[model samples]
Target: MAAEPNETAQVNEIQKEYTRIDKDWLSLHYKISIGMVLFALAVECIMGLILVNTDMLNTTVPKFVFKFILVPSGVNGLCAVIDHMVVKSEKISQTAKIYTVSIINTVICFSLFTAHSAFTVTYYVFVTAIILTTVYASYLVTLSTSVSGLALLVISELFITWDVDKPTIFQSTLRLGNFLIALFIMFSVSMICMVVIHYEKRKNRASIRIEEERITLTKRLKMDELTGIYNRKALHDAMRDLEDCNPQDNYIFGITDIDKFKNINDSWGHQTGDKCLIAFAQLLKSNCIKANVYRYGGDEFCIIFHHTDINEAYETAVLIQDQLKKVEFKEYPELQMTASFGLAQYGSGMNAARLFMSADQALYQAKITRDAIRIHEKEI
Candidate 1:
């Protein structure tokens, strides 16, 4: 019983954190990645329209645009478009999407690396490595897993082709060693970032747990111990809030008392008396489903019908009375039990206290004729 609600609350809290992390990551990734695409397009425009025309880099303008600008931009643009769709789809977890994006980025870096000598890609690999570690995950588990996979792919490309570019074994060895050093640097940087991210996630979970405990404490303060319904303090607070509404706003106010409550406690015991109260409280809540019922104290309870009229409130009270007659106590089958109700409505200019006094007076009248319902004489 206790376990179920606690587990559900924990799951709910986790889902909220999951949603926030997903939304934040998607927003950040889309902005930064799209910006990267724009930068690539800018390079395409400048190098093709101006720089290539000046015969710089000894490459044809069209060829340079196709190789350096258009190809990379097209791939990056496609990635941005696909990433947006995937992250927003709801079916895919952001963790999986992060991995997908990391792999794509690694491929992009690999493209730049393979297309040029190792010396030319220092700025590109350094920036990519730093950006790769920024997406947060659990205890560094997810971060490290995804980053290591991408790192391996990039490192694997270093030895992929031993073509004319590396004519000698020593030159190829040096290139591999250089790229290996960069990979090591990237891995070290990622390890530090993951530690920071792990700490932040722990802090977030701790904050949520604190908030949950605070709410539970607040609820306990307002809840009845035996009956599990709103207590006297809660009832008072509710009445205050109700009275804060406009004077003209109508509401039903009522009180209920167990028919011969003291006799049950005296005859059976306080424990049985408590069981009766709990059972009676459950019945009241079910019958008055539209209203809030409070276990005002022993043998006394209150109900509030927000925005309901006198007639409906009275009808509901009658139902509760009828239902009580059919309710059975397993311990004392021969003993039949019933409850009396007194109902009133908030008339114009009536404050919370006055309205409840009217109900209490009617309740007094009902008590005179046990197991009966009475409307306030003023309303009659």
Candidate 2:
């Protein structure tokens, strides 16, 4: 058999909640990525300044060369700030920013090669740093599958540069071996980081799916199959929480029961009686503006209005009765049903059990006195 209308509504609500949580997680992740990139740029700038002041290079060459190398690091920082301000899911904009930074770094490396006649050990180190930083940052910003290809190109360039025979301290076999070992280590670390990131993304997606399923199951358990409202158990749990919180403002609890419901069931079939209950539940839900509606057992409904005054609660109850009079039960065109409501407001002496009993007593009075609604008034 197909699920009832109430069950479908509950499922929809749970799905909405899960979607909201997932979006929040993604926003937080993007913010953290932006922060990390900014920090990395700051460290790179400090290292660049230190290199210009040290005895590593002759003053005759000028310090602007070091400054030129740091330009791409500055660009990375600017891109990170721009990415942080944009809305989430702008993947095309993010990809463009990352590619622009990568191209700038490549240009800087080529410029450095042209500036020097021969590739010294320090120059090779600087070029390798630029290539590794470009590849890693591109991978972070894009999560593209072609990052490994770019890394291989970098490694190939390093090997080709080392093959040139020149009178330099970097031409020894021991230095060549060290350079190869360092390249291998960097490649291995980058591959490992990529694997970990991919695994985490998969794990997070699975966890989100599982959480959605659990929320669906919990909704089914707490909701009434017939009335599309909280079951009696759920109602009690909510009342307990309200009682524990017990704010300074007043709260109202109202109980409503269908009048002469058994007579309608006896005259018509039980299916028609079920239809009447469903129609009445929808009426209650429509009338509940700031209150929570609950299915408080068969033929009985409850409403809890938090942070509401007694006068407002009474006015709301009268409005609900007025609306119910206009409902024409389509399934049973000739049939009509009326409801009796009893309301009580919370005060210093009120507890959940006592408040419920007070509403029940007022409801009994409404049924006996032929009144549509009754409010319990304690004598001053």
Candidate 3:
């Protein structure tokens, strides 16, 4: 059987609500991720400049090493800008590509810094150890952190093997101790960042789920149990909406009631009468495509048509009456049912309640006159 008009409308509303929520979530996530990447890049640039100019490091490091560090750091900053632009506007694939480029740039920085021979054997070892720590730290910032970690581990091992015995102020044990401390700090920072990201994602997911549940519950509350159509509450809600409608837009109000409903219940039992009502509601829903159908109460339904003229509304009412002639009520083979329709078109200064009353009075007139449908026209 066809669904009632109100049920279909509710389903459409739910779909629109979910689509809106998902789009908003995706837009927000992109903006946040982009902002974070940009901020990280800005900080890195400032730190690089400070380190290059500071008295403590400027005199100690060679010009070549200084240039090497600055150049790659600049390149990494540029790549971060590109990442921010792409990630803020595109899907996950774009974000993944940006991250991939970022890792490659980081690799270039590691290679440049490690190849320089300015450091004493102990200092070189310490630098290699820092690179390895950074590689592991990268994993916390990125989904592909493990790949970076493995690459750094291999590079560090190779560098250490190549430079086994050069003289330095510090012994190997002290260098090792410093390396361990640096690694511990890097790992701790990365862990903190990862925890924050995970928590935010969890919170967003929970909010989306709660919103979906609320929409579902609201729909159920407004729906009629038998015909799966909008109940009396839904009619009131729609009527309330009419108050703010633009005056230029046409509106049609209709009320429909099943003919001889009580007699059907008395002669064929209430169950069969229910089946008839359900079937008839489906008929109204299927026929009235441009209308909002509501179950006003037992054996009575209402429809409101937005942007409809009097002639079109009357045509629709006639179509619905004709459509009911074909419904095959299987339980009572001899039973035939019809609906009476009353319609009113909106005019200046007509409120929703008054419009509904006008339609209801016309519906009463149709029932009294035994006509299939009646339309209320404003007096000339």
Find the candidate with the highest lDDT and give its number.
1
Error of 3 at 83 (Å): 3.6
In candidate 2, clashing pairs total 0
Clashes of 3: 1
Descending-lDDT candidate ranking? 1, 3, 2
Better of 1 and 2 by lDDT: 1
**Which sections of candidate 3 miss by over 4 Å?**
1-62, 65-70, 77-81, 84-141, 153-202, 378-380
Candidate 2: what lDDT? 0.61
Q: Give all candidate RMSDs, comma-separated.
A: 5.2, 8.7, 7.5
User: lDDT of model 3 at residue 343?
Assistant: 85
Model 3: which ten-residue window has the lowest total lDDT?
128-137
lDDT of 3 by residue, 143-259 (tens): 344345335534653454322332221456655554456445545544554565567566656766666677778889988999987899988888887777775688888998988
- Residue lDDT tens for model 1, 95-157: 676666555555555544443342435324544634544555454434544465456446546
Model 2 worst lDDT window (10 residues): 129-138
- Top-scoring candidate (TM-score): 1
